[model samples]
Target: MFIFFGLFADPVSDVLLRISEAWPDLKVVRLEHPISAIAARFGENHYDLSRDKIPTDILLMTERLSSETPSARFLLLRTECFGGICDNRGRILLDGRTLFEAEGDGALRRLIKFWGADIGPEEIFEPLGRSFRWG
Candidate 1:
């Protein structure tokens, strides 16, 4: 299965890579925020992040997309929540809930299982605890 972990410029990629390694079969796509930002900075390219955007008051092309493919997985592995990354386009893809708030292991595993998929051991650590383990 394909799992997307949207991340901004941060140490999130480090953690996500570790998790993806544990699950060899799962396809994990790491989308960088700078790439999206570049797309935003240069609009003609049509760098649609996920073909999902929701209109909001602050921006024109602003849009929101949910996990329509319950089976197709995605996770927000960034430092900030949904509102922090809301851009002029307003097309942010992710729920407002924090990764910790998503209940870590249980919620994540369930989401995978529900889709008849398997999950790797990608532990979500807080910013302060980021250096505990770098394996």
Candidate 2:
């Protein structure tokens, strides 16, 4: 029940499409708005923040994927790899340290791979190979 919001629609939709095609039983829900927005708009205290968290509590946000400036970071996740930075070439950094970098759609793929590790993509379908993953 990993809820996603911070990331853009490009990669998330791509993975969802593939997931739907392979595992029909796998449940993947895309909310029209973030939980915070929903709670604020509807005036309903549905989500209990103290007792329960938003699923896996993972949020990956990309500031500027393609840029030459040092200020252009690749990702900003909520947990695990939160605050991960990227160089002008999209190299990942954790806690001002280096983890790995991706070429072309590698950033998205690596995130997907991280997602798979948690959700067990291997148990459901064939490995999500890296190829034209970005659109």
Candidate 3:
């Protein structure tokens, strides 16, 4: 099972589709409002931080969830840009350990690789006009 904590730079539908294609039997849940989901899944006390704190609190949440549910995997994605500089970050956690972490275009590439997707980075970035920072 995979739980997505936030929106990714790529389209949600496309990302979900790719994941499903890679793991047909895998179940995925996307949570736009993670606080509510966490409360419902693990009780309110499991997440005490406010929405703005999510970015920094993700690891703690993932660790707790992993301890409680051995099969669960957490994917957290977030992007920030300033002064014409953009940073896209992605983290994958399973069994209380981070499986992958990357920034910028590498984040998307790692995600595709993690899912065993046959598609290349060009296939994904092409639609976005390759707007993602590449170095």
Candidate 4:
């Protein structure tokens, strides 16, 4: 995993958000927890743009993660193949895929081109194609 290889930063909030969106049928009581921020812990390097992902490493990781069940497999996709944004509306674009569950729930729109150096929202367009729609 990214942690064992020294890639440290907790995306707990993001993870919870994605989980809620992906499995909207389930209830997610995403309460806050008082943990130290990875930024505060690692500072500059935590958000470092220069940290490029090694192809072989990621492939190996993907292979390892894919060995799990569908639900678990989703985590692999979320971790490696997805880029999400909520737009100005309270909706989630799960890796630029369907987000019918969280309609009008959040209002923060963020454009993230990279989640490290390996993934982006634009990349999602390819796998899902134009067959998908926001509405």
Q: Can you list the residue pairs that collide in candidate 4?
A: 90-106
**lDDT by residue for model 1 (21-126), tens:** 3333333333332121101111212234453332122122111111221221233321222532211111123332122224333444433332244444442322
Clashing pairs in 1: 53-63, 53-64, 54-62, 54-63, 54-64, 62-89, 62-90, 63-90, 63-91
Candidate 3 per-residue C-alpha lDDT over 1-135 given as tens digits, one digit per residue, 9 for 90 to 100: 112224221222244454444334433444332111111121234334233234445456555555444544555554344553444566766666777777676565565455444345542422122242211
Error of 2 at 27 (Å): 27
| lDDT for position 36 in model 1 | 17
Q: For each predicted model, how many residue pairs clash, with residues at least 3 apart or on different chains?
A: 9, 0, 0, 1
Model 4 local distance difference test score: 0.25
Better of 1 and 2 by TM-score: 1
* lDDT per model vs. reference: 0.27, 0.27, 0.42, 0.25
Best by the TM-score measure: 3
Stretches off by above 4 angstroms in model 3 are 1-54, 80-86, 123-135
Candidate 1 lDDT: 0.27
lDDT of 3 at 71: 46
Query: Which candidate, 1 or 3, would have the higher lDDT against the true structure?
Result: 3
In model 2, where do residues sit more than 4 Å from their true spots? 1-89, 105-107, 115-135
The global Cα lDDT (0 to 1) of model 3 is 0.42
